[model samples]
Target: SIRLPTPISKPDRSYRVDVYDRPQLAAFMDAVKDKYDNVDQYHKLAYLRLLAFTGIRNGEARALTWSDMHLDRDEPFIDVNKTMSDNTGHGVVINPPKTKAGSRKVMIDAETANILKRWRAIQGQALMRRGLPSNVVWTNQRLSGRISSNQPREWLLAAIRGTDVPQINVHGLRHTY
Candidate 1:
């Protein structure tokens, strides 16, 4: 093989983080609440609000079970000790946090705690209607299964479709928090 010179290193380019501001976030929340009032819609709204108010990663949030959340405690918090990882051919699996520090408890404000409470009540009723057990915090409204990982992002996209708010990925909401 012919000798080749070393490749030149590219300069680092900093990109701005895209996130919803106060007014935009308020508008987005209002839009979601006003447009979707059903139990299933409430679940989706709660999920979005949680991500917006907490900086936890998407996988961390997805991996959360009802056991991982302590909403009734004086200081409500969700333990972020694991993440939902795609195991390729084996399908999705729950795994420990990537780092020791990744496994932490994220506390929520009273408002958020109330939102979660409402969501749980609504979810419980829906599950009872379908004769399904309430195990996961985020479950498919029409079926007996966890909500798909892409569902939250899809909901966010649809909520901001015609609004003046800038479009952003679900992760951006974490940054906004």
Candidate 2:
């Protein structure tokens, strides 16, 4: 049998973005208001807020579905079912989470619950306008062939382009929460 030496741990100097202030956060979302319609705005905001609130990875958020949402129960939660990767724009597909612990339910607060409700309502209307079905929570309908996992980065960049923001990346928003 062959034995391998233990790997050394490197210092985690990577930027932890979960440090945004309320005003900055508000400004960031407000700036993107025009880039999306009511449904798209709600969807982006809901997903971003979920990332911020739950510390879930972008892949996890992208793979969420209406079936995973437990909105009726008092302790409303999102079941972390799967994660996704860029599959060359075919469509978003489900994959396992990074670890066993990553595949769990995350309970959301009332504020997030309200936002999810609003997004659900707007999403239905948006689907109706596009003549698509309402079963899928996230879709590429708005971005031609782009997946939902990539929208936050693009949308956030567009949001803060002309603003006085310090160029914090969208992934940073997850850490800030």
Candidate 3:
């Protein structure tokens, strides 16, 4: 016969947090801008700027649609009510914030809003060309209408490569805000 073990409580955790300072951030943004202008990857520039300005989580940003943003209004703000999560890595699902605190409005700077507007124009033209209408803010002209969570990490790597910027995950953009 074997003895059975009792349930145990979860242990505390320590995470290594890395964030970028001013110069590093500028370099990364410049790199992303170059990609956006040279290769026309508009989403790369828009994504990093939004995360850095808003301090919102990855899921929150991914779940956002044009309806959630009031960019043209006098006071631009994002209504962060839902988030996208895919723990299984097979698919993504939209979910409401588990806590009341998770759902709130985040104000964005004018330049950030302008960046979004420019991205919208570019995306809008492509969507019109394809005769498909999608409100997803991070699609990058994809028919899928939404971007995978890993996409941002790929952008980060590309932006930091051969640059003075330190290696950091997409979450670091939020921390830098």
Per-residue lDDT, model 3, residue 43, is 71
Against the true structure, candidate 1 has what lDDT?
0.82
Worst ten-residue run, lDDT, model 3? Answer: 11-20
Give the Cα lDDT of each candidate: 0.82, 0.70, 0.83
By summed lDDT, the worst window of 10 consecutive residues in model 2 runs over 141-150
Alpha-carbon error at 7 in model 2, in Å? 25
- Give each model a TM-score: 0.85, 0.72, 0.85
Model 3 RMSD vs true structure: 4.7
Candidate 2 TM-score to native? 0.72
| Cα error of candidate 1 at position 99, Å | 0.3
State the lDDT of candidate 1 residue by residue for 3-80, as single tens digits. 999999985433323887898789878877775656658887888889999888888888888888899999999989
Models sorted by lDDT, best on top? 3, 1, 2
Backbone clashes, candidate 2: 4
Q: Give me the runs in candidate 1 sitting further than 4 Å from their true place.
A: 1-17
**Candidate 2 clashing pairs?**
17-176, 18-175, 18-176, 19-176
**Candidate 2 C-alpha lDDT tens digits along 37-141:** 365466776766677667777787777778888876798898887887877766556788878887898888887788777877887777777777645566665
RMSD of candidates 1 onward, in order: 4.1, 6.1, 4.7
Q: List the residue pairs that clash in candidate 1.
A: none
- Candidate 2 residues lying further than 4 Å off, grouped into runs, are 1-18, 21-23, 26-40, 88-92, 129-131, 142-148
